[model samples]
Target: MVNSTQVSYFTLTAYFDTGRLKHLYFLVVLTLYILIISSNVLLIVVISVNRSLHEPMYMFLCSLFVNELYGSSGLFPFLLIQILSDVHTVSAPLCFLQVFCLHSYGGVEFFTLAIMSYDRYLAICYPLHYNIRMTSNKIAVLTAVLWVYPFLSNVFLVFVLTVPLQLCGNLINKVYCDNYYIVKLACSDTTVNNICGLVKMFTVILGLIVLIIYTYIRILKVCFSGSKQTRQKVFSTCTPHLASLLNFSFGAFFEIVQSRFNLSRLPNMLRIFLSLYWLTCQPLVNPVLYGLKMSKIRNACKDLLFGRKIYL
Candidate 1:
């Protein structure tokens, strides 16, 4: 109805009329959201209340859980509303806000995992020196960087680069707002935006990947050489982190591919699943992975749920 510069809101063209079944879809999404909130909150509370879980590793995990909640909150509420509402549209400001929140979530998630891997490497490789190396002050600094970097970076990019873009269209062909798609919709010359995006992908995102890989390689080197008991200990500690990394990586891969390639040929439901996978799966899977795999978290969660005062 309007040109790019005149656009005030975006039409999410991906959503179709689910008819009366939308109520069922709404119920399903609501239930899933509740589960994510409760599970993530549960772990955060468990770690916070249990003095035994106040270690550096658990502290990192608590941050991860909080990030999951932060990320999920970006989409799930808006998703529930869109599922029920006939109009699948969002104001430009709200759309930009969602993009900011989601991007910050992703950046923090990756850096947190990277930090966790380094923590693992220290604990396994250095052992006795880990405490000295990973002191409270160091942990606090690392934590601050992970949270603040993503936020500052995202807000700057969204507010400065994205918010001012002159879009050619307002139709966002996804279930939710994405910065990449919004850039694609821009009518103005986006050479600078494109350059910045590529730089970010290769530098910030790739740097985190390399850091994680380097830490894991060192850990694995130590793992294979250590005694069987040591190997088991490493396996127990590293399994959840590896699983989480792989899960998030897969979803991110799908997202990057979908944004770059022609994925419109896929079924609408399948496409929707792929788009939402990274955001939804991580929040759900992290709690399960950390809770079930780590005995400490597992026992803490069990005691909390069953009203038992026992601490393992």
Candidate 2:
């Protein structure tokens, strides 16, 4: 109601009066959280333990799984607490931390997918040179960049742009902490935040789009010209990667639409789903997509759980 600095807690108005059914909702959310954690951790452990599966692609997958855990941790616990409690408010410091964690998850996820596409491009287009180009050292460095760049960007957004702003109100319409919504609440001028945010979003999207498009186009060329064996190889590996990319993009599109546009006319249920979709679905879906689609991961998971040895 006053300044942003004075608003130490933000009231989340998006949560409805669930009444007695709050228990049921809590159970459902808890179950989903458990599933996400179990599945992602399983895949990460499978990749790390199986030395044979520690190639560039799977290693990047390990990083992806780790980010899923990171992102899910930022939201689910908060949701569970709010579901049971009457007051749906979060401290400003905790809110900023959540924003940072979730934003970094999204950025790292996108960057990781782009790098995975490039990895596929190399393996398929230049099989002989894939190892030489995507060496262990280079893979480590690229992985580091994906995490570091996103963290720094989010740091700028949350700490530099948002934390210092004055607020006229403490009500956030959505369930979780969002950088966009936080920026929107600024009683102070947000000209720089808007301009910088748009530029950052467009620059990242455009560059990654070009990279993904070029890699896929080249991969397609190799697929058609190469032998049946080559085609099969590309199909197996690239299928899961493409599936993951499309899945994440769909959820992310809904999120961006809700953030950028005025969608308050929509049902609260739909709006809440739109806000949670990207963070919730990606973590749950990725492990399933990769675990079931990638033969080695599938077998490895089975071997880990069922106590049966299988060769990759």
lDDT (10s digit) by residue, model 1, range 41-106? 999999998889999999999999999999999999999999998999998878989999999999
Clashes of 2: 1
Candidate 2 per-residue lDDT, tens place, 82-191, comes to 99999999999999999999999999999999999999999888889999999999999999999999999989988998888988888888898888888788878999
Candidate 1: which pairs clash? none
lDDT score for residue 263 of model 1: 85
What TM-score would each prediction reach against the true structure?
0.97, 0.96
Q: After superposition, how far is residue 62 of candidate 2 from its true place, in Å?
A: 0.3
- lDDT winner among the candidates? 1
lDDT of model number 2:
0.91
Each model's Cα RMSD: 1.6, 1.6
lDDT of each: 0.92, 0.91
